[model samples]
Target chain A: MNGSVLSARTLRNLLPALSLLVLLAAIFYLQPRAISYVGFNLMLNLAIPIAFATIAQMCVITVNDLDLSIGTYVGFVACIGATLLSGGIGALPFIKDLQASGALPATLPWIMNTPLAGVLVLLMGIGVYALLGALIHLRNLPSIVVTLGMSFVWLGLSVLVLPVPGGQAPGWIKSLMTLKTPFIPFPIIAAVVIAVAAHILIMKTSYGAVLRGAGGNPKAIERAGWSLLKVKMAMFALAGFFGMLAGLSLVGLTTSGDANIALRYTLLSIAGVILGGGEFVGGRISPIGAVIGAATLTLAGSFLSFMRIPPDWQIGAQGAILIIVLALRTLIDRAEKRR
Target chain B: MNAEPGFIRRLVAKPWLWAYVAAAAVWLVTILFTGGRGGGEVLTAAFTFATFSVIVGIGQLYVVTLGPGNVDLSIPATITLAGAVATKVMDTQDGLILVGLIVALACGVAVGCFNYALIIILRIPPIIATLSSSFLIQSTAIAYGRGIRIKPPAALADFTTAQVLGMPVLALCVIALAAVMEIVLRRTVYGRWVTAIGQNMRAARLAGVNVGRTRFTAYVMSAVFAGLCGYLLSGFSGGSSLSMGEEYLLTSIALVVIGGSSVAGGYSNVPGLWGAALFLFLVVTMLNTYGFGAGLRYLSTGLIIIAVIVAASARKATR
Candidate 1:
């Protein structure tokens, strides 16, 4: 009896992933040439930023809150990073003088030219997002409205920084992202590390338990003398950090900053989180499940592209799939609750 | 003798009065900044904003009042599809305008019914249900139109262009619609039922209200107005495109929220919504005139919404 129950639980958990694998296999069989190793790598590469954004989205949603500014934050970080790298901030003259005086390496002409610069850009993103988070928590505002508003603010800032898309990513950065080392790609490693860290943080820590308890019953949490604001702020900060990571990964992939790169990711990430078995009312999430879900979505896009579907039609198809997934999840949830 | 404060309270609680005051402020600000861009142009823009606001506002108001975490994310898709269908059908014959309107309304009703089936029969949460429906709507629209643009009929165009006492025909229509909606909401059994459901579904059900039916009806009413808005917009603009309805989705929700409606549902202030609509229009116009660009427009609008919601929350916290 115990063995059967364990098997059923395992089957329940594996259902979504199994379906994804089947779909991938069918696609591969139908289009053998298109489903090459290189194509798979490309799919994984493209899915990296989306997966990161989805993880960020998952963090907020785990608290029973939505962060509508995920896309805008990604856009802001990318544009700012690009602009800083390109000397778009009118610091070219200073950098040139410094280069001539041997104060900076002649080989590296980029502004703030180093891997350390990436850290700064990421910090800036966190700072801005944290400020917004503070406002939301301190003012006791709804996360959706506040985040949506911040998205606009971030978009505007991004436009002001880099009105058009054009920037060269550093060679090292590009190579680090694109080149596969031994058994796995760097991005996959990074994703695994981040996912594991996040999973541990949420599942194994006292803070994680508090966050879950608070989300499940806010009044109870408050009665227990916990600061809801602190928990929310931390979640928002973590989300922002992930958003920066996503933006940086996107920069590495595209080698440029396009204002619209992050737009669809916002909604898609939310869908991905839900698909990964993340509860809307806030609870535990399986990071591996989320990564698989992200892969499934990316594969679906590639499959549609392989079928020669029009761009607009592809968008429509994605939207339809999102709806269908939600409907299915809802149905399944209702059934389980009934049982 | 002791009811003086009560009378004062009633007067102060009047939402229409607040809406008018807000509208006046927006108009005053526009006039001061534009520095006389010709009264005709100002009036034209204001009329356009008012008409658009009324339609979108009505759709949002219904959803917000439906309770149970109900929100129509698919409203924009519905609007876009309705506009496309209206324009396509009306182009064959001027008389087909009526047919187009009926068809659009019917489509809206069908979509609403589908949502109801998902939410009630399938027992999906309202948020997920509406969001899914929105996706289906977008997909259907895309498959059917493939980003195609359709031109409006002459009769509909003329109707949109016509003016009454120096005001646009669309503006007059919007006012009439608002008045009718206000009356329906305040003095009808449907309105009472909606309020009850929004407050507490269990309590409403216990009191003998058909909870499912009320919720369904609310969505249908919301969708119908959304369709009407879409049709009017297409006629007024002289054409319909694939993304025509996308912009209104966020705007409608923002306006409804700014109008002081709780996201959780129950109490709704129609006048507050009108006020929010006026404020949004003014902000957009200002951004345009100042050369703030589309990016800035998006940013500022979002920021303002956040600010307003935050302020409201702060007030609640204080209370």
Candidate 2:
């Protein structure tokens, strides 16, 4: 019995990496050209933004709450990163005249283009999410409803900032994201760094244990003299911070912004969390596994494209992948119980 | 004994009262802006559009009433697939209206079963299961219709648009349907089982309630209602498009919440559904009439929803 339990635990931990490796192998087999560094860069660079988004989602899931607005919020941040952070709000209709008439300088280099201004704006966005967490706790409201409502607010803000998706990502962000390393792809290095940092923060700290305890047994945490509300707010703010990272990275890659861009990330991030062995109600999550899961999902898309699947069927294929992975999880869980 | 409050106070204490009051206030504000012009026409339009919201909102309400972490995110996809299949099969033939209706309901049943199977059998969470299933359903819709917009049969379209005494016939029919459902919710054993399971699944099981079956029926019922809405909406709009069901996703959940239904489950406000639906439709119309941009409109909608939820919960807390 002890041996079976140990094996099950090991298998559960290994699934994410194993799935990723198998997928990579399949891709390598399908196209030998994809085995090189350049091909990997082309395939995995987009996974960077997805990995960030999944981490953001895992943060919220850590506190046993979900953020339905994360996708729209990311789009809003991308709008800001492209327009306001880039030193021009030229794309907005009302501000266009101000920019043209020289009333507002063509670029506010010292004031808006600086990294300080961007960081401040992203911090304010995180503050908004923290406030949302406070509201949900104070009123005893459901996170799903509150976040669903907030999605519209973010979507509206995104549109107001960049109405037609024409703003440019700042030069520094683009350069940083595309920075070449010695051997491996930049995205892989970034993913590894993110996963390691998040794992250290969440799985190797005392506060992290308190936060998870707040989700699993709030009464006990309260009895232990910790504030559940504060933990929830911190989780939400952390999620918002990562969401900002995701949006900025996405804009850096695309070099543009749109109100509706990244809207699908809401669902995609949730799938990534589950695919990484996160649970809905237990506050169970793995940061490293989630990043790997996000990369795997992104690679799955490329794999399908390499297989010549039509774009129309790709959505269905994604759905099928989610179902199959979850089905496998169920089988493993049952085996674990039987042991 | 203390004196009982007056009738007005009693009415105000009811949770569903605020939705009706809000609906009336919004309608009045819009009418005042128009200087009373087209007031009847506006009411007619509100009823017609609110009918669709009510149809799907009822289903969503049931699913939500199954407790926290229970929601049908595949509703929009289910509606789309049903509409696509029904229209493509009917092929604009008036005589095959019944056949189309059956086929749409069948699609709903299939989707509901698949969604539940993912949730129960595979042990996936309801939200994720429905969301993933929706992708599959939407892809099937795309493959089947190839983005074709098939017009409804002329007879069916005409019937859907038909009105009597300035009110839509479809609206009246749905009103009756809501009434019947209210009875089922309050008087039937199945309804009580749903309430019990939502309140406490373990306790309900010990009390001999068939928790799984009750939850299953609620989900299936929700999907079936979505199917009906798709069938009717396609006829009303004159065709079925891939994007036709898009708006219903948020609209369904919004209406259910605004209608005074408890998101925590176990409590449902049937009467409030109509009031909330009409209020939502009028809120959009009011914003459009005032010439507000889409950004402002959406912002206000989100703010207003948050305000309503706060007020509702505050009232419950105080009581």
Best by lDDT: 2
lDDT of 2 by residue, B1-319 (tens): 2445677677886677788899889989999999999888888999999999899888888888888888998888888888989998889999999999999999989988888888998987799999889888888887777858889988889989999999999999999998988788879998888877778888999999988898898888888888888898899998887877877878888887898988888888677899899998898889888888787777788878888888878978888
Q: List candidate 1 stretches off by more than 4 Å.
A: A1-9, A85-88, A91-122, A170-172, A183-194, A219-225, A307-311, A323-339, B1-11, B14-20, B34-40, B315-319
For model 1 chain A, the run of ten residues with the poorest summed lDDT: A85-94
**lDDT of the candidates, in the order given:** 0.73, 0.86
**lDDT tens per residue, model 1, A207-307:** 88887776778778888898887777777788898888788778878887877778877767876776666766745566666766676667777767767
DockQ of each: 0.49, 0.71
Instruction: Give the number of the best model, judged by TM-score.
Output: 2
Docking class of 2: medium
Q: What TM-score, to 2 decimals, does candidate 1 have? A: 0.89
Candidate 2, residues A1-339, lDDT tens digits: the string is 899989988988888888889889999889989867888889999898899999999998887888888989999899888877876434444577677887888775454445556557778999999998889877888888888889888888888777788688889999988989889989889999989998998889999888778778888999999988898898888899899999999999999989889988998899888888788877789999999989988888778878887667766877887788788878888999987
Tell me the tens digit of each residue's lDDT in model 1 across B30-100: 66767866545765677676677678788778778877467777788888878888777777478788999
TM-scores for all candidates? 0.89, 0.95
